[model samples]
Target: MCVQAISNPRSEDDQEKAWQAVCPLVNQLRNYYEFSIALEAVVVDLLSVLCSDEMTSRQHLEMQQSLFKQFAEILDFTLKFDDLKMTNPAIQNDFSYYRRTLSRMRMAGGDDIDKDLDVNNDMANRMSLFYAHATPMLRMLSDNTTKFVSQNKDLPVENTTDCLSTMACICRVMIENPNYRSKFSSEETVLFCLRVMVGAIILYDHVHPVGAFAKSSGINIKSSIKVLRDEHPGKVEGLLNALR
Candidate 1:
């Protein structure tokens, strides 16, 4: 019924045996439908469940919160390409729901209004809700990757280049939420934004090594930022402009 119920691989021997038999047919379906389509479906379902108006009651909120926490734990477990390869449409739906839930939680936490500012102590408490709700999910995702590597054994801890993906996701958030920049004075908001930037920058550095991003992209950034200060005797200077 929940995303967590469907997202994990069956650990039982009989379940794995069943999946092993179905793997071939699943590959056939993969040929007809790209993996990304399936990924999107999963995201959509999870979002629907999370944002449903039916979950408005305080008691319902606590229940959903608990379930979300569990979903985060599931993410921590190792998820393999094979583990996700199943032929059962129903099972696949479940798995997709789980993955989508993780993505939704991650983005929502990062984009929370109260996360980046210090306007009030109450804001800090509100920001804590994001962390409290998300820590488990973060741990789950991390654990899932780790478990995947452990299971594969031969897989190396190679740097993964995810800059374009990160940038694109950030762009989507910025475009969708125009007020993000205006919350900079809020302590919770600033902390969250800084964390996102720092994490992204670190990932980029790890992937490209030797500051390739700075060398390749900094020039464009600087040129785009340049502005003319005067008209008669034009003085041009590059300045970091706020989007807000």
Candidate 2:
């Protein structure tokens, strides 16, 4: 039965049916890290199916948002552990799969990867619901950085690095995609976006390359730090060093 669902999803209806059939199994197994690595990949691939551009309806995008929300919970489950060792290779592979699928989605649904995004539009509000749910997952990255550092335990620095790399890749896609950028003009979204970027910088190496996208993200992070100069100068400076 599971094989039928996973083997040949034929249409939008078929994909949705496959997801419905497979999703509950993913949720039930996600808690067992050692046993669920392959399950995670299969589930994330199903997510890519749901997010495909052929759906082409506002309602389909809403379904995509819900799917991402579910993925975020799975990520949270993966990170709920106290240390990174047990999670290392499985989590790394999961994130790598995520990067590939999201990049495909971005290119399929996005604009020129090298262009600057228009700041005037709301980006179909794909981001409107996504960031709200994804924020907690990003925060888990931030918290893990500090926790690992403070413990003086073996820091799986690469875990944070992989996440920032995945995020930077996604950020580049967003900044380059006009629809995605339109959502950033809202003050709340703008600030929240900078907070996550800056927090990652405080934790790891530079994940983005020389490009308009990276430059823009850098500018926003610097500006946000300046605004909070009086409130958290030390952490702000830490972010600056991370950027450098």
Q: Could you tally the backbone clashes for each prediction?
A: 16, 1
Report the error of model 1 at residue 218, Å.
Answer: 10
Give me the displacement of residue 188 in model 2, in angstroms: 21
lDDT of 1 by residue, 1-244 (tens): 1112333445666545544444343333333234333333443343344334454423333666654333322221212121233212453543234334334544767545334322222432332232232122222333333343344444232312232123323423442354865645654443333233323332233334343247663112222222112111111111111110
**Lowest lDDT block of 10, candidate 1:** 235-244
Taking all chains together, the TM-score of candidate 2 against the true structure is 0.26
lDDT of 2 at 18: 55
For residues 144-231, what per-residue lDDT tens digits would candidate 2 score against the true structure? 4444444433534343344444433443345445788787866444333434444444334332233213554333444434444533
TM-score of each: 0.22, 0.26
lDDT computed for candidate 2: 0.39
Clashing pairs in 2: 123-179
Q: Against the unseen true structure, what C-alpha lDDT does each candidate score?
A: 0.33, 0.39
